[model samples]
Target: MNFELDEELINYKEKVRAFALKEFTEEVARTHDIEEKYPNELRMKALHEGIIDFMNPWKTMIGIEEMCRVDPGLGISATVPYFGAEVLMLHGSDYLRENYLAKVISGEKMMGLGVTEPGGGSDVAGLKTVATKNGNEYVVNGSKMFITNGTIADFFVTLVRTSKPDDPAKRHRGLSVMVVERAFEGFSSNKLTGKLGVRATNTGELIFTNMKVPEKNLIGDEGKGFYYIMEFFNISRIFVAAQSIGIAQGVLDRTTDFLKKLEASGEYVGEERKFKLAEIATRVEASRLLMYKAASFLFNYKPNPTITSMAKGYASETASFAAETAMEITGQTGISTDLERFFRDSKIMEIWEGTSEVEKIVISRMILKGEKNE
Candidate 1:
């Protein structure tokens, strides 16, 4: 398989690297993590540089991956909103796209995805948020938990149940996707602080208490929201894998640099550290290959459920493992303020988007499906 990126894509990657180096200094990265503040300015810079509007999902994934290599929190703050806009572009009506996509791409408006509820995590059909139809609007009720950018988003792409519960088989049938602005009546958000990682990216709970959303705000067709959401998940999971891979790469790079310095000063190669570093590097390379395979599937628009799961599972786990190794190698200095933040941040990569257990389930399902087909 040809692994070389095209010239245009290579140029785009270079652009992203230049922007990150110029705009995302070590001090800025530290302040973001320490203060748990959103990187609003950096996000705007990314928008202006066209990193947010870069059309190809594969390219966008790579760009985000590279950005996360610098700082995962900054990368999330910079790219996650575009994921929402991408949903609108792919499934919303022309009016919705016209109104929302440009603003999102321009960074004038921030958007968040709302799917997980207080009780629902992996079970999309189990979401409890309700939306009752009115003449020209829908009245929404219920809250979304653990929403990224929830506290600061200008608009939210939300999934709500419109059908009754009596029909268990039809639960996924009557779900609808709609857009709700933060300014809507009865809509509110509160920030969730003290997170273990990615603290610079805002995470919060969004409450919709009889909030009214315009009829035109509906995404795609009515009752097909579940399918659309699933499709979105297929694409988005790959992005998360890329982000995790980038984080792992970053940890690996730092560790390698640290190891080299230690070796230069005759500290790391003392027969004890050799095997540990070798093992960690091997695992990191495996994770990178899995992530690249996932991206290849996405780039070709091929169905690769197994590869996607493998990518996310391996990359996230590798990120954590690499961070742990880095800490071990660096000893007290790694746990100190200089490197401890990255280690803490790396842990969350395994938990968010989808947990490692959930990824294993997905991979197993795909394997079973393939076996049955054969």
Candidate 2:
């Protein structure tokens, strides 16, 4: 089987890498990380440079990888302006697409996704946010915690409980997705600072107390929000896998460079360090292949959740592993250099989108159900 990117994709990947290396400088990344700020200027610049291509999922995946390789925080910040556009593209009404998605695509606005609640971590079906239908509007009263781009987004594709499920055991029912604007009355967000990593990407808590949403904002069927969100996750998990692979690859690159510098300076690098480096390289390559396999299935519209979960779960773990191993190899030098930032940044890969535990659950459940690989 051919395992190479097409000529066009290869060129685009190089272009993205060049753009990232030029823009995502050490000083810029350090400032954003230290200040816990989002780089809106970089976002706009990438947009203007045509680096943010959503039409081609391959380009999106490659761009994410190359950019994050340079600097995870700035890389994510530059590309996260359209965080929840998939929901709109797949399920939203024409009006929603024309008015909202169009603006986001044109760089006129930014968006976010609101799913996790105050007490909800990986329990997506257990969200407490509720939206009550009133006339032609829905009055929403609930809060979302750890929402990406929460404060800066012009709107959010939010999930809320529309009705109580008749069956207590099946609590995933009666949920709905809708677009909630930041300008709406009673809709407020508190920017959260001091994140463990990816500090350049905005995070906040969304509070909606009697926030009114137009009925037209509803995406797809009223009770199909859960399925829609799940589908979105299947797509997003691939990108997270890409992000994880990038971080792992980045750590490997830095560690290899450090070892080379030591050897060039007449210092003998130990076999243990060489073995660790080799293992990191192997894991990075494996993670990339898994991510590509998952992406192939997903981009073709025939998603295999087992493979996708496997890719994301394994890649995230690899990223953390590579960073930690690099630290062990470089010791004090690694701690003092920018590799320290990568060490901090690699951790969120295991926690966001779907946790490693959650991915394990998905893979095991799918396997037990005898889901065939397509």
Steric overlap count per candidate? 0, 0
Worst 10 residues of 2 by lDDT: 75-84
TM-score of 1: 0.94
Number of residue pairs clashing in candidate 1, backbone atoms closer than 3 angstroms, sequence gap of 3 or more or interchain: 0
lDDT of 2 at 221: 92
Task: Report the C-alpha lDDT of model 1 over 327-367, residue by residue, as the tens digit.
Answer: 88778767764457678878877777678988899889878
Which is the leading candidate under lDDT?
2
Q: How accurate is candidate 1 locally (lDDT)?
A: 0.81
Residue pairs of candidate 2 with colliding backbone atoms: none
